[model samples]
Target: MAELKRKVLTLSSGKQIRLYGNSVAISRSLEIGEGYAPNILSGNNEQPGNTSAGVINPYKLTPDELMELADFNIQLWMDLKANIRRFGVSSPRIFTGESGKQPTETTGNKKTGLSSRQQATE
Candidate 1:
């Protein structure tokens, strides 16, 4: 059997935790339901508003709803990744943008952790 992918995260309290990438857990928890696709909130106004006055806005998540969804998703992802030893926390943002390096765009092997571009360059 192939070994599961793993990651180590350091908490704000100076404690470290290990997480595993479990395929089954991730699929079960993170899979989107049928006919429901949540759009990522973006700054670009691609869909221009109607110029005429009195146009009702379409359905959208309120600020609270957006925050709740974001927090839920982040927590769900962490739980799925660390299925074997669950670590529940709402502070996944600690890893966000902390590293100055730009995120790699290339797809990587989940088992080997080697990106296609990295393999090609090697």
Candidate 2:
């Protein structure tokens, strides 16, 4: 496996955003694969006031637009949290050994002290 790298983006408000491998993984999972069409949020111009008053209102998004934004926000938050948990802290070391020997292995060509499946049988 390639060594994992971290990316941190600092927002204008001074909040730090950290992205790890898990973040990219989650994004890939949510992406629309080949042969899938993306949904486009629709919007239309709305005149809320009387036309005779000479007032023109701005464009407004339909209900689907609001829902899409909400869903996107929720997923973004979830992915952020998941990535942080996956790589934010260093994991504890399970074994230690000197330079020449593998930490999980000891003396013999018998694969001494290893679990049955890990040991090579003659």
Candidate 3:
């Protein structure tokens, strides 16, 4: 099941906007579907072409905040990707579990197995 969570973001001006889903899932999807570059080089004439990500809408985030949110999400994703590589998490879902039990996981092993990921924290 999709769990809905809330996040309170305080802007530079001391205004707050409540974002949902732990972190805005919108950030990443928008960054891709909206053609936002997380890193903008100096002297670049173009500032990301489109602001619309056809399917998902950024509910209450302003254009400026949306850009910030994209960078936020990009950094988080990159960190996670690097950690996944370092830890060699090939099938994370096998331990996390999705809809059904993983094929290679046995009931006894699942109960007794202690993985190193259990020790790592963000």
Assess each prediction's global lDDT (C-alpha) against the native. 0.47, 0.41, 0.43
Query: lDDT: which candidate is best?
Result: 1
Over the stretch 7-89, how does candidate 3's per-residue lDDT look in tens digits?
A: 56565666765553233332222221222232432223344875543323425446797789668767655654554565456
lDDT of 2: 0.41
Best by TM-score: 1
Find the 10 residues in a row with the least total lDDT in model 2: 30-39
RMSD of 3: 15.6
Measured by TM-score, how close is model 1 to the native structure?
Answer: 0.28
Give the poorly placed runs of model 2, Cα more than 4 Å off.
1-58, 89-122
User: Against the correct fold, how does model 2 do in TM-score?
Assistant: 0.27
**Ten-residue region with minimum lDDT total, candidate 3:** 26-35
TM-score, candidate 3, is 0.27
Q: Locate the minimum summed-lDDT window of 10 residues in model 1.
A: 93-102
Tell me the TM-score of each prediction against the true structure. Answer: 0.28, 0.27, 0.27
Check candidate 2 and list the clashing pairs: none
Backbone-clash count (model 3): 0
Could you give candidate 1's per-residue lDDT for residues 27-100 as a string of tens digits? Answer: 22343223222234433333478454442224565889878966876776564455334323443322223232
Model 1's lDDT to the true fold? Answer: 0.47
